[model samples]
Target: MRILARRISVRRTLLKTGSEQVLGIPKSGRSRAITISPQTASLLRKHQLRQKELRLSLGDAYRDRGFVFAKESGDPIQINNFGQRSFANLIESAGVKKIRFHDLRHTCATLLLAKGVNPKIVQERLGHSDISMTLNRYSHVTPTMQDQAARLLGDALQF
Candidate 1:
């Protein structure tokens, strides 16, 4: 499954079930594809190689259910576990504002919108059910967008 330039399809989500995590459909019951740069694709290829090496070295000891990111044993890291065990320590070490794991999604959307990617494209990338949801949820991040739009309008209207 060496998918190219990384048109990564997000199909399954890890859900906490009892003491274990199980793979299931996303909350919206939809699968979405996200395109990545060639550089990102190259890095992911390298990551896959490293993971393969680890899996081979561990032999049967590796859990190996095939997660893009995983623990040494190959078991998927539950979201809560990742936030509590890694994200918090990582933030403290990096000296950044403490942010919830879910906040990363917001940040990504905000950055893309700020960069002036079309709202429709952002909506698909975010798997938003509709354009209004994306626009409404991200309205705060678009004041700068409004300024740019006005400037462009002014430029176009110049005699």
Candidate 2:
């Protein structure tokens, strides 16, 4: 996890579409550079430290591993193999409804927009090349945000 300016370069999915059928990611596009809040950065840092400790415990056998969690055969880490099912089961056990992993990204965008973050900033953070993409995805802004915008304009006009 590296921070470059307001962007955070992370090893994320880079899928290609259409008939060409490219399975793997390119060197430049595979690594995503996105933005994150300070709190998220702190949490990720802590998680990385914990992962490092776990790797150390595994000794030289774990040296130069490509994933934070993976099989001994060196396949890419997957949530199904990394306790996601267990996590969902726990949530269900706790009376929560089923939720897909992709929902987290939607939730984050909704929260950011609700908090009055500029759409452009949100688009950049989500790695959308255009602001319209972000706007189209999160078209419904919270009522509280609208009220806040009105109040801000009123205050600005007071001068």
- Candidate with top TM-score is 1
Backbone clashes for every candidate come to: 0, 0
Query: What is the per-residue lDDT of model 2 for residues 52-158, given as tens digits with 9 covering 90 to 100?
Result: 77677777766544554445433444554344775677768889777766666677788888877787877766667667867887546688878988999999999
Q: After aligning candidate 1 to the native by TM-score, how far in Å is the CA of 43 from where it should be?
A: 2.0
Worst 10 residues of 1 by lDDT: 1-10
TM-score of the candidate numbered 2? 0.63
State how far residue 134 of model 1 sits from its true place (Å).
1.8
lDDT of 1: 0.82
- Model 2 clash pairs are none
In angstroms, how far off is 49's CA in candidate 2?
1.8
Q: Can you write out model 1's per-residue Cα lDDT over 78-132, one digit (the tens) per residue?
A: 7887898799999889999999887777777788888878879888888888789
Give me the runs in candidate 2 sitting further than 4 Å from their true place: 3-7, 11-32, 68-75, 79-87, 93-97, 139-159
| Model 1, position 108: C-alpha lDDT score | 76
